[model samples]
Target chain A: MSLETPLHRVEGLGSSHSGVSHFWRERVSGAALIPLGIWFAVSILGLAGGHYVSVLTFFSRPLNGILMAAFVVISLYHLVLGLQMVIDDYVHSPGGKVVLMLAARAFALACGALSLYALLEIARVF
Target chain B: MADNPQRPGHRPRPLSPHLMHYRPTPTMISSITHRITGVGLGLGMAVLAWWLFAAARGPEPFALFLSLAITPLGQVILFGFAWALSYHLLAGIRHLVWDLGYGFDPRSANRWSLVIFTLSFLAPAGLFVLAYTGNGGYYL
Candidate 1:
């Protein structure tokens, strides 16, 4: 008896396919955000009442600085994805939705890049 | 009369379900809350990133941010943003728990959801009160 090959194997997978792409991306980003988010909350809490120099000193630590940069980038990317979904659901006009989603994504990337740059400067790595 | 009024050969039309007909489940409510908080966090994070950038720039920019933050309207917005941040963070951890193949039991899920919701709002509110009362510092 000959064994039947799995569907994907027989299909000879290439680079592209469709279905639930956005859903799973959001879920994975959501999962990563949990730990990144906890670290963020704790870090911010530690900075309570800290003045400018104090805050700078706190971020000057290499590990803390790196984590902050990662957290900001990841969180901002995740935020844009989540907001895009919300806009898609609520905004009925196609043109408006596309414009808004693009704007949201651009804003997120800009924020992420700026935050990362600031963290790097604080770390003296820039 | 058409032979295909309910013909097996014909494809069925898609029928969207009515929300009012079905009772909402714990999972459904939690999912909705997650999305709501997710959106809230999106806006909150934007503000936070802006705050950080301002601080990184110099005292002038930081003071500009602080002036807005110190205003009554700004205080309310900050409070709401904090609540959103806390809620989204807690709820997200709850989601991670579910993702790890635990907390699927209905009772536990419901209990945890309530716990997350309560703690999310209360923790931030408590801190805000403490700050406002000068127990921590003058946040207002």
Candidate 2:
């Protein structure tokens, strides 16, 4: 029933689109989260009732500091992507949707930066 | 603009067959809860950011943070978050498996959902038991 040639039909259907990258990044970040989340849960449970010094000492470890930073950055990025999808699906007004999306990105970035700064201080970066 | 038999002065408004249109099933409930929990966890991150800010501020502020964390209301919030975290973690894993094109059949999907629902509670309960037994000194 179609009249188009194979080459014509194939035009513009390629990997140049943004959707593929977004899909992969989301999945990759999710895969990264499993182990990182486990580590974080156990570590936080261990530090739950500790004083500042005790918590600081645990984070002061080189590997712990690095992994904590990675967790904050990656998780925040993933969070923003997930939130953006929800907003796009639910928000009908174009102007309101854009504003909400931008606000989400801003909030995630701010939180990620603050978390990194705090981790650095804990690890005595200064 | 013209009157119709069904409505003398107006036309029937277009209505979406929304939530009520579909019969509720386990998978439906699980999917909806997934979105709700995602939003809840996002809000919980704000509390976490506050904790980190206080911790970085030094011992006095951190102590103040702990004081607030242990209040009756604080404990409620903490335990709520723990439950949320457990449920979200299990649900997330279920989603990841689905992403790989597995568990689409109704029987397996329902079974997995039931398993997730049970384990969500058990995970947090186990943690509490450990803390109470003095094995999880972190909770003290």
Candidate 3:
């Protein structure tokens, strides 16, 4: 028989199967944040001189609402992944690391929910 | 050959490098700041989540939240959060440009990094001023 084995056998059987890809994913998220971040900044800046009602109206626009929702989701996802890396690096205790990661995920999810709710409210107001 | 460094009984010990011996570069510092802002953003999101939930709850909770936010400590935290958000956002953009096979040159990278640093603080400060004063009162 040849020395080479089946691809599945070489792929590894456990959680470590896709570990390398996770690092690349974190970088990819980081890259995405750049334009998203600038867009958010410019959008907020445009609202600077407006009143509360005007600000509300701006978000009330369908496109604006959609963009805002996208921003919220993307920002939270990036934040969670970034925070997870931080926890993994510093929280050496296994239990503490797991707890911290879970907490980070929960916080991100809460932010996402609140942002979506706020966007929906804006849509209703319009 | 018998003279080889590899020995049957003696396992080679890995050499650990000293951090102090390494030279730091702009890329290294940028990477570090990216991480710092990331953590800041996480904490900032917690504060923001609280604000959103409070606002959704009712006027009373919002008023309570507003009161807390107007305090000196609250303002500082908010200001810091704003900067953190801006920095992370700008830095993320820089990374995106680099990833797209653009702005990879040393000069352009440094220039963009400087722009990100300046805009991060400037955008947030401008927003705070508008938010603070445009509400007709000192705090909003």
Candidate 4:
């Protein structure tokens, strides 16, 4: 019943006549996050109360390192988008909202960079 | 009632549905709490990123983070973060379901709102229980 390709964003034919790009992208990233979130959560739980050696050894694996990097990237992408929407809806002051959005983006980027550095350092990829 | 001069509690109001004009339903509260928990999780990500960055720095820094993290305050914060992340995940799933054009009826929507809250709390509490009970000693 649809003519558009899977590549195209949906909801472009309504009365508003615009695509739901933000909503679409958010959902896509969120769908991807389910497994990543589960992996991180359960793995963290397993490491619970363990010592530094255990933690280091866990991250030393190449697969864990790669998954950690993927997790950080997707999470930061989702985080920035979610924060932008939150600020846009709630912040009444124009200038303040813009500043907050920029700050949120900066925070996500920082988190992403730090996470990658740590994972790579643990794996001795550098 | 506000549109009629003779009606009681009459007052001018915006044409659109104003937030203050309605009673707070579970769905409404859940919608807002989704954002609140989201912001909480965002802040929690700072802690996570710090943990990773510290680990990369050295064992000394890693131990320093652990020293602080095992403290009462830090444990509390971490617990809150866990709860917030679980809550957001459940809430996000609910939103995704709605996006797929299901659970739109008021009855189902409200039920889902409560379900999300209940499961969100329960899931983390269960995980924390298992986490803290490992090997009759510190598991982390």
Query: What CAPRI grade goes to candidate 3?
Result: acceptable
lDDT of 3 by residue, B1-140 (tens): 22346656888755555445568656666778889988888777667566545544556766687687778998898788779888877787677667679988777777777777888899888878766676422211
> Lowest-lDDT window of 10 residues in candidate 1 chain A?
A11-20
lDDT of candidate 1 over A1-126, digit per residue (tens)? 535457655664433443466656867877777777767665665565546676677777888788888778778778887887789777988999999999998888887877876777767732
Worst 10 residues of 3 chain B by lDDT: B131-140
Worst 10 residues of 2 chain A by lDDT: A12-21
Question: Which residue runs does candidate 4 get wrong by more than 4 Å?
Answer: A1-18, B1-17, B135-140
Our tally of clashes for model 4 stands at 6
Task: Please give the lDDT score for candidate 2.
Answer: 0.77
Model 3 clash tally? Answer: 2
Q: What number of clashing residue pairs does each candidate have, in the order they appear?
A: 0, 0, 2, 6
> What would the per-residue lDDT of candidate 2 be over residues B37-130, giving only the tens digit for each residue?
7777777777777777777878888888899988989877877777777777788888889999999999999888888878878887777676
Clashing pairs in 3: A34-B92, A34-B93
Error of 1 at A73 (Å): 0.6
lDDT of 2 at B106: 100
Among incorrect, acceptable, medium and high, the docking class of model 1 is acceptable
The estimated TM-scores of all candidates read 0.73, 0.86, 0.69, 0.84
For each of the candidates, what fraction of the native contacts does it recover? 0.33, 0.36, 0.28, 0.50
Collision pairs in model 4:
A48-B139, A48-B140, A49-B139, A49-B140, A50-B139, A50-B140
Candidate 4, residue B11: lDDT: 68
Among these predicted structures, which one has the highest lDDT?
Answer: 4
Residue B10 lDDT, candidate 4, scale 0-100: 70
